[model samples]
Target chain A: MALVEIKNVRKNYGTLEVLKGVSLDVEKGEIVTIIGRSGSGKSTLLRCINALETINSGEILLEGQSVSAKMDGLRQMRQKVGIVFQAFNLFPHMTIEKNVTLAPILTGKTDKQGARKLALSVLERVGLADKLKAYPEQLSGGQQQRVAIARCLAMSPHLMLFDEVTSALDPELVGEVLKVMEEMAAQGMTMVLVTHEMNFARNVATKLVFMHQGRVWEQGDPKTLFANPQTPELKSFIGHHAG
Target chain B: MRQFSFSDLLFLATALEWTFLMAAIALAFGVPVGLALALARTSGSAVLRTVATALIELIQGIPLLGLLMFFYFGIPVLVGKDVPTVVAVGAAYTIYTAVFLGDIWRGGIQAVRQAQWEAGACLGLSWLQQFVHIIAPQAFRIALPATVGFLVQLIKNTSLASVVGLVELARAGQMISAGTFQPLLVYTLVAAIYFTICFPLTTWSRTLEARLNGAR
Candidate 1:
């Protein structure tokens, strides 16, 4: 079974259909990058994977278990699926160390001392070991995004979702966040990301999914999909991004 | 006419304790009740939101003096017994504080970005856990200045307890003024005493508000 299975999912906000019959699968250790224009439902599909946005129809399965809005076992499902937002919503009141440690401790995965050690290792992974004492506001946008990723990694999730994580960073700072994501992919962590960064999508993503008008317009190896241009939509999309 | 004396000043000073006591009772009990009301107002259930909204609007709609009189005069008539002035006044202030503080805190909680709640939930925290660990602290910072401001108002409002014969600060000043026929002098001193208590609090609230805004 695929690690994450999305089968014909649909979502609507009022009369606007955001995700229209979207279906995809993320196998273990695969890095899938979803690239689309705004309002094309790329982020919505990623959010639905962890049941953040409830599906109007169809289903999402995480390792053969259904992901639903039901409170029962929903939290346990979410614990294994870590998602980082574009805005880097790190708890401002908490120190970086506290932000990384809170979930692990609250979930009983580790005690306070163990959480501290876990936080150190994860912070180190993101190359932010020096920022353990800093508040989110004290850090730059890139640094804050990295801390947000580290905060997620402390949970030891099986799958990581990045929702336009670098879209909010300054031009010079985007590389650092992408570098951290590349490292995660290199370590063979399964990831599904919605991004506007074409270079990252082209170079790092194992599988590329192009979404257009609330549907997966094309999907295949990143290089092949980008090179071949299966449809006029993909053609125009690649053309627009190339400029 | 009797002159305003040192004895009368001492009496007013003594009456200040009752004022503090009423304010304390209002705060100590009101804050928790207010929190519950806030949570209810913001909860997912429509029924909880509706009920809390109704209660808040009902309490806030009535004048505080009306509430005091209702508890003191209205309740005694219904219960067929004399209600103690302190209990009646305390009850009125507590309910008054709860509804106002509830609405204030509700706005604070709502003012926090929607993403904060989503972040907590994505981390596998339960709704209550999200509230206690994530949302509450941020909301508390947002609500603090207004809370202290409300506290100042609460202290000043405690003087209203005098209407029911509680002999709190304002009533003591009234008694002294009646006897000495020195309303201006007596009231000035009373106002000075109130200023001593409220000025620092308003300053503190402003400082807190400035620090919070600067931090953000």
Candidate 2:
């Protein structure tokens, strides 16, 4: 069975339907990249997988269990899922270590010492071990995103979601974060990335899904999808946008 | 009529207790309830949002004096029991603070990026966890400046308790004036006391706001 199975998921915001009957399967340890125009439900699909944007219809199964708002559902699903956002939503009031350790100590019921140990290990993995005392605001954008990723990694989740993780960074800072993500991918971390970085998708993704107007326009291996001219939409998309 | 006395200073010093007490109580009750109202105001449930909106508007629309009267007179009639003047005053101010604080906090919470909500949920955090761990902390940073500002307002509004026959700073000043027939000096002294208490807080609030916004 796939690690994640999203079945006919639909999402609507009032009168507008952002995602209509979207479905996909992600195997364990496979990196899937979603590419689409703005408002094409790419980000929305990523959000739905994490149960951030509640589906108007259909179900998302993680390891053969539905993700719901119930306590048990949260306890089970959350243990397996982690997410890094575009804006690096670190807790401003907390230091980097605290931001990473809060969940494990609180929800995972890990002792403070154990959680701190795990936090430091992940911080080191993200090459930010020295920044254990720094606050989010004190760090550069790329460093902040790395800390955010470290925070998620402290959870030791089976699957990680990245939503335009480098979009908010300066051009100079983008490479640093993408490098960190590349390292995670090389280490066999399962990821569903909604990104605009064409090169990252082309190189890292095992499968690429293109979304257009709330539907999956196409899906294939990155090399085949990005290189071969199959559909007018794909050709036009790759042609018009250099990235 | 008379030079500043130890007795007068002692009286003012003692009255500071009431000011702090009322302000502290108002905030302690106001903040959490106000936050809940703020959440309700922005909730997805139309009915809950409408009810919260109506309550906030109603509280904002009426004068605090009118609220004092309603609490003072209306409570007695409604319950067939007389409420103490101080309790009525505190209750009125708490209600008033809740409305304004709710509005202030709603703005604070709304200032947080939408992606933060998505990010929190994606971590498998429940709605309550999102508020406590993610949204609330950021909103609190946003709410802090205005909360301090509201504290100053609460301290000043304690003067209104005099109308209900509670002997707060303004009431004490009025009593001194009636005895000495020295409205100018007595009220001037009263204003000075108020200024002394409020100026530091006002400056702190402004500095906090600047520092927070600047940090962002």
Candidate 3:
């Protein structure tokens, strides 16, 4: 069984349908990049996988178990699935160490000493060991995003979801964040990215899925899909974004 | 008009004690109730939010005087018993303060970002955990200044208790003035006393609010 599977997911806001029977599969340790025009439901799809947004109909399975089980089951599933957002949503009132350690203490039930040790370890991994005492407001945008990634890492999730993680950063700051993500990929973290960074997707993703009008217009190995996209929607999307 | 007497001054001091006591009691009861009302207004359940909002609006809509009258006059008939004047007056102000403080606190909680809620949920935290760990810390920072401001209002509002013959600050002044027939001198001194209590708090609240936002 695939590590994560979405089977006919549907979502609507009032009369307007946002996701129309969207389905996909992600293999273990595979990097899947989802690309689409704004409002094509890429972000919503990522949110649903994390149960941030409930799907109108259909199911998501993780490790062969339905993801919509009891709240505890869902929380247990989330323990394995980490998500990062475009905005670095670090807790402003907390120090970076506190921000990173909060989930471990609250959900993982790790003691203060253990949680602090884990927070420092992840901060070190993210090249932010020196910033453990700093608050989010005191850091640069790039640094805050790195802390956000570290916050997810402290959970020790096997599957990571990144939703437009660098779109909110200054152009000069984007490379630093991408570099951190590249390092995660090299270390074999299974990642699902919703992004507009074409080159990163082309170079990093094992597979690229282009979504248009709330469904996958086309998907294949990056070499095949970008080289010879079969659909006009995919062609237009790639054409407009080609470097 | 007789010269300002030492006894009259002592009476004003006694009245000041009553005012502080009322403010302290209102705060002790108001903070927790206001926090609960704020939670209700922002709860996931629409019915709870609606009911909380309606309760707040209902309390705010009725004049504070009417609420005082209800406590003073209506409760005896409803409960088939009499309530002490001080207890009845405190009850009315407690309800009034809860609604106003609750409305202020709702704004504070809302000042936190929507993303904070998502972050808390992603951690698999129960609603109580989310509030205690994430929402409460942030909300307190947002609420501190406004809370102090409301406290000053509460101190000033305590003067209204004199109408119910509570022998608090304003009532003490009225009693002194009746004996001396020196309303001008007596009320001016009373106004000065109220200012002495409230002016520093107003300044402190403004300063703290500035400092908080400046850091933000």
The most accurate candidate by lDDT is: 1
i-RMSD values for every candidate model: 1.6, 2.8, 1.9
Ranking by lDDT: 1, 3, 2
Better of 1 and 2 by TM-score: 1
Q: Over the stretch B1-216, how does candidate 2's per-residue lDDT look in tens digits?
A: 666556776676677677777777777888778988999987779998899889999999998889888988898899898888767777888888889999998888898887676566666566788788888878878788777887788889988877877777888888777767878887898899999989999898888777766654
Once fitted onto the true fold, the runs of candidate 3 whose alpha carbons sit more than 4 angstroms away are: B1-3, B210-216
**How does residue A186 of candidate 1 score in lDDT?**
98
lDDT against the true structure, per candidate, is 0.93, 0.84, 0.87
Model 1: per-residue Cα lDDT over A79-100, one tens digit each: 9999999999999988999999
Model 1 vs. true fold: TM? 0.95
Number of the top TM-score candidate: 1
Rank by TM-score (best first): 1, 3, 2
What value of lDDT does candidate 1 attain over all alpha carbons? Answer: 0.93
Candidate topping DockQ: 1
RMSD of each: 1.8, 3.2, 2.0
- Model 1 chain A, poorest ten-residue lDDT window? A63-72
DockQ score for model 3, please?
A: 0.56
